[model samples]
Target: MAQMARSPRQLGTLIQNARLNRDLTQQALASMVGTGQKTVSRIEAGHPGTKLDTLFGILAALDLDLQLGPRNKGEPDLTEIF
Candidate 1:
């Protein structure tokens, strides 16, 4: 079941869902990722300030992995915008 995240909020929602589905508490996941509960909470809250490394760490702790693929049809090129 691969989930596509089109935005930071969507990514956070997916992470939160994954965490809850695994029956993992914020503190527990934070511990696994060598972070704090508040950090996990902020990531789950879709805080833009959250670092990419932090997000990856959380994903690793949740047993999730990242994959790169072609953009969906009609998707704008983010490279041009960024």
Candidate 2:
């Protein structure tokens, strides 16, 4: 099955769902991460101005981690290069 690409809104929705599933309010999460409720709300609304640190804080607060990897396949043999 092909994985569907998620937009910012979709990503935000996923985060929001997780937050709600954990019975957390925006204010609660914000307080946990030492940020303002408005920051959390804006992030949940897919605002582009959300800082990377803020997002990381929220993710950490929610016990989440972000992973990044190559999207395409490419492998090289060292012997072949030499």
* Candidate whose lDDT is highest: 1
- Against the reference, the lDDT scores of all candidates come to 0.86, 0.75
Off by over 4 Å in 1: 75-82
Instruction: Kindly list the per-residue Cα lDDT of model 1 for residues 1-81, writing each as its tens digit.
Output: 898776667778999999999999999999999989999888887778887898899998898998878887787666543
Using all chains and alpha carbons, the TM-scores for the candidates as numbered come to 0.83, 0.74
Q: Provide backbone clash counts, one per model.
A: 0, 0
Candidate 2 Cα lDDT to native: 0.75
Candidate 2 per-residue lDDT over residues 1-82, each given as its tens digit: 1222145565587678779989999999999999999988888877777788988989889887776655443544334333
Off by over 4 Å in 2: 1-5, 72-82
Q: How many clashes does the backbone of model 1 have?
A: 0
Q: Flag clash pairs in model 2.
A: none
Model 1 alpha-carbon miss at residue 28, Å: 0.8
